[model samples]
Target: MAEQQKEMSFLGHLEELRWHLVRSVAAIFILAITFFAFAEQVYDHFLLAHIKPDFITYQLFCDAFQLFGIDSAFCNVSFADKKLQSIKVTSQLMNSIWSSLILGLIVSFPYLLWEIWRFVAPGLTAHEIKKSKGFIFIASFLFFIGVLFSFYVIAPISIHFLYNYQITDAIENSFTLESHIGLVTNMLLGVSILFELPVLIYFLTKIGLITPEFLKKYRKHALVVVLILAAIITPPDVASQVIVAIPILILYEIGISVSRRVIKKQEKNANKS
Candidate 1:
């Protein structure tokens, strides 16, 4: 048994990971089927809610602007006249299916992470596993926060900008079903993954792959990268980019602190051993 364990190859690990992925994918599909049953309701009430102008985010921003007697576009924004087109016969159907899958992934994210944890935890020492046990909750929390931020903040800005961007009065903005859903889903997934920075740093620190000093040393570079990411993910506006970058920068700082704590703990553990 000892020899068999010691002789485990890369293929063995890959096989194990494959099973974990299969399980995770199965969970997502099950959830997707559930969402698919209410596809129309999900599409209108949840996915397309941001484009309604009466979304909670829009209202709050409008009220905030009004309270201070400031003029803002959100104050007069209206999406009642807006419409989504389906050029292809199958576009609407495909979008509904894809959107359901994305929603499934989001809804089952915690379970997905739990599946990942089960795969990886066995490779770590008991102490390490115990220390990192909160990985699922923390990761899920960050992911949800990112999803909410993207939906309420980034999605609104992008939708507003694109919907109102008129080159000429003759040209009408007719967004396609695919394009609309694409933007929202991309933003949701991208930010959700980005928000897992601290969790990522903790793992890297545990494995001696990174240190707080290295993060500090490359802080400026990380800022540039974060800003670039913010620009790519958000609408082309300084305010929007800044808004997106602030939280990411803060996450990076928190990641550094997490790294420091991890390193300190490892050193203390080694000394005790």
Candidate 2:
């Protein structure tokens, strides 16, 4: 009887998980439809805004340079010679659909995480569930922060630098629309995942796969990797790479702290047990 009950419980959990997944997918579809409806405005005002010379970042930097009595590239109002191209007739339509889906996923991330948590919560011990009560909020906050960083700091700088770079006078710097969108999407998604470092470390530490000591020991290596990652995600310029790297390094340090806290909490729980 006990074995039969256990099997039934397992099946029930799976059923619940299926429902959660269905709901999450529905949410995504709804948000995607909304994004698709406003695709033009999204592309013009949000995605392609960086291409304009009078973009907010450029204007702010230009003002700062003037105040400091410096001749900055931000003071210049034009890209050297670069244009986005679409080689196929279906490219624009395909990009619009895919980009709307990505936007939908991003906008619905919090609810998706909530559904995941709801599905997993029943399997966790009451104490464990309580400890993770703020999981959805923290994860969503970090993810959005990463998204903003990628959009405002990483994307604009990278676009400006790459669009302006000239290897030779003969070669034109025309990029494909697919290439530009791919770059932006990758950076945003990558950084958002990266920002979950602290949460990941917390869970790993809880399961004894990570430790504060281990993180500290490999800090230098991690810094190098972070710098390389920043360079990959941002522009080739030193300033751009450094700007992107700083927050990431800070996140790494925060992960270490989170690991320590998790270790301490586990130790306390064990003692109580």
Q: lDDT tens digits, residues 1-273, model 2?
A: 999999998898889889999999999999999988999998888878888898888888889999989988977868535568999999999998998888889989999999989888877999879978899999999999999988887888788787888889898777888988878887778778778888888888888998999999999999899889877766568877788788888989999998988888789989999
User: What does candidate 2 score in Cα RMSD to the true structure?
Assistant: 1.9
Candidate 1, 39-122: lDDT as tens digits: 888888988988886788888998999999998999888988888889998888888889989999999999999998899898
Candidate 1 ranges beyond 4 A from true positions? 1-16
* Runs in model 2 lying further than 4 Å from the true structure: 1-3, 79-82, 235-238
**Best candidate, lDDT-wise?**
1
Please give the distance, in angstroms, between residue 73's alpha carbon in candidate 2 and its true position after superposition. Answer: 0.8
Best by TM-score: 2
Distance (Å) between predicted and true CA of 272, model 2?
Answer: 3.4
lDDT of 2: 0.86
Lowest summed lDDT across 10 adjacent residues in model 1 is found at 2-11
TM-score of each: 0.91, 0.92
